[model samples]
Target: MPSITLIVNGASKSLEAWDPDMPLLYALRNDLGLHAAKFGCGLAQCGACTVLLDDMPVRSCSIRIADAAGRRVVTAEGLGSPEKPHAVQAAFIAEQAAQCGYCTNGMVMTAVALLRAVPRPSRDEAKQALAGNLCRCGSHERVLRAVQRAADSERA
Candidate 1:
């Protein structure tokens, strides 16, 4: 087994990966107990498994653990705490952006990255940013609103 150390959230963690080819999602979920990134299509088409890899959104399901060695990985749980949620997380709650809540993790992570890059993205830009994330709960409208609200909140 090979040992891989990852900077998860803001802390460093070392784990023995029996197979370095294992997806990073498993290490985050099974080993580190970070469950925000859910298993979706597993092929990386769906953004349910999105996480910030070096401040960019990447599908955790397809990113190999070996490839992510010595990189910054921030899952949705690492975004914020319940008492003080990230702007996007807080906006999601305020706008009721989630029905089943299955896609919220990816949405928040992507939104966070988008905001970091673009700051105040237009409605179309937000939609484009989240186009990959699937939310079958018919929450697209709310999700859009949540992104805008988050931008506004951050501005304030």
Candidate 2:
């Protein structure tokens, strides 16, 4: 087993890797108990396993545990705390953006990354950033509104 150190949600954690080929999604959920990032398509076709790698959103399912070493990994769990939630998370809650609840984590993480780059992303830009993420419950409209709300809240 290869030991790897990962900075997840601004916290450093060390885990023994059972397989070098283990996907980050498994490592995150099985090892570290960070299940906020879901498992949809193990092939990366779906955005259910999306997480932030050094502030950029990446699909954890496609990335190996070895590849995640020495990088900042942030899942939806890292977005905010119960006492202090990230603007995106807060916005999503206020706007009721989640329908099935499976895709909300990925959506929130994507929105967080997008806002970090563009505080006031246009509707198209918001949609574009979230293009990889899919909501089977069909909450695209609410997701867009949540992004907008997050942007507005950030400016406040």
> Best candidate, lDDT-wise?
1
User: Which regions of candidate 1 fall more than 4 Å away from where they truly are?
Assistant: none
In model 2, what are the clashing residue pairs, if there are any? none
Task: Give per-residue CA lDDT, model 2, range 49-154, as digits (tens).
Answer: 9999989999999999889899999988887887888899988989999988998888998899999999999999999999989888999999999999999988
C-alpha-based local distance difference test score of model 2? 0.90
Candidate 1, residue 43: lDDT = 97
Overall local distance difference test of candidate 1: 0.95
Each model's lDDT comes to: 0.95, 0.90
| Candidate 1 residue pairs that clash | none
Error of 2 at 145 (Å): 0.4
Deviation (Å) of 122 in candidate 2: 0.5
lDDT of 1 at 16: 96
What lDDT does candidate 1 reach at residue 143?
A: 92
* Model 1 Cα lDDT, one tens digit per residue, 26-93: 99999999999999999998899999999999999999999999999999889999999988999999
Query: Model 1, residue 76: displacement in angstroms?
Result: 0.8
